[model samples]
Target: MLRAELAGVFRRRRTLGLLAGLAGLPVIAGLALYFSGSSHGHGPVFLDQVTHNGVFLALVGLVVSGQLFLPLAVSVVAGDSIAGEAAVGTLRYILTRPVRRRRLLVSKLVAIVAFAVVAALVVAASGLVTGAVLFPLGRVTTLSGFTIGLPQGVARIAAAAAVVGLSMAGLAAVGLFVSTLTEAPMGAMAATAAVFIVSLVMEGIPQLSILEPYLMTTHWMAFTDLFRVPISWTGIERDLGTQAVWGLLAGLAAWARFGTSDVTS
Candidate 1:
């Protein structure tokens, strides 16, 4: 069941388009910088570093996409998980089969999570390739003002991608819950995206400082800590913990709603 779910999720044209679009960001950025001959410290956070080391493009792509692009992409996939099936009048038919609701729900969640992980890695991988082709690939500088070999730097970038990918778990669960609330995939997608945007907006407000510690977007950028000489785990640990709590709450809510709801479609 899980394998079928994954295959279905990956075989869609929409999924391919999303992945391609993600990979395009890094390639476009690399081309722009390469053609323009930008000097040191002239571009955004990681792009500046990319000028010195191509490996930084991986970090740059993750940062660029993590903000809204990646989350929005996740919203589309996850929001469509259950709702899309229902909209197409397949949810009722599927429920008539021997598959349990719990198992089906689990499968959908796994598919979305898988999509999220692949989406993140796509950004990292494309960035690395583009960066390598456009700029010099060599030693990478750490956030702590130290340098590491190219292989170690690449490993850290891969680690950062994994962390960023897992960071979407909370959003994926929330999207699933929202999906269960409606039959319209667009509605669920919009609502899920709104949740992420609202969280980001609230996190920016001064009065919301107390709530910032729990917002899904709060520790997203903490992946940069991986580039530190000693690698700080405080922010990354808190980020994963927060995601786990959110995922648990949303998953329970989704199960309750899905298990009890009538399947007319």
Candidate 2:
């Protein structure tokens, strides 16, 4: 079932377009950096200059996309999972089968997560290839001014990619939850995107100090702290914890909504 769901999603033109757009972003960034003449600088060129500046910049763009576009992409898949079928009058046929609601929801969630993972890797691969082509790759310089050799730099990039991917699971769960609430695919996508945008806006308010910690957007950039010298696990741990809580809550909400949903209509 999961495989079938995945195949269906991959066959969509929207998904293919999104993949192309994501893959092109880093290449565009790389070209921009190359023409900007910002590559020349002092101190271990590989560390102080290339890796730090290039990778971090690419990451910032990737993170921004994650916060904004990625959720929409997840919603594009999840938001359409059941609601789309219902809209097309195919859901009644699906529900006529003996498949359990829980199993159906689980399969859909798995497919959504799988898509998210692939999307993330596409972003990372685009960034890495761009970084390596436009900027010299060797060692990386930490935010705290420490230098990491080439091998270590490679490892850190991999770890960073993993962290970013995990962080997005929260957004994926939110999309899944929204999916169960509506028959309109656009509504689910917009609702999920609006929530993140609102969170980001709220996170920016100076007086929202009390609300910031509760905002998922606040912790979305926690992976950036990993690049600091000595590597601050505190922020990353908190981020992961918060994400886990959100994911669980959203998953429960999705399950509850879907279980009680009337698909016979």
Which model scores highest in TM-score? 1
- Name the lDDT value of residue 190 in candidate 1: 96
Report lDDT (CA) for all predictions. Answer: 0.91, 0.71
User: What pairs collide in candidate 2?
Assistant: none
Could you tell me the TM-score of candidate 2? 0.86
Candidate 1 per-residue lDDT over residues 49-80, each given as its tens digit: 78778888888899999888999999999899
lDDT of 2: 0.71
Judged by lDDT, which candidate is best? 1
lDDT of 2 by residue, 85-138 (tens): 767877677667756778777787777777776776777677777776666665
Q: Which stretches of candidate 2 lie above 4 Å from their native place?
A: 39-61
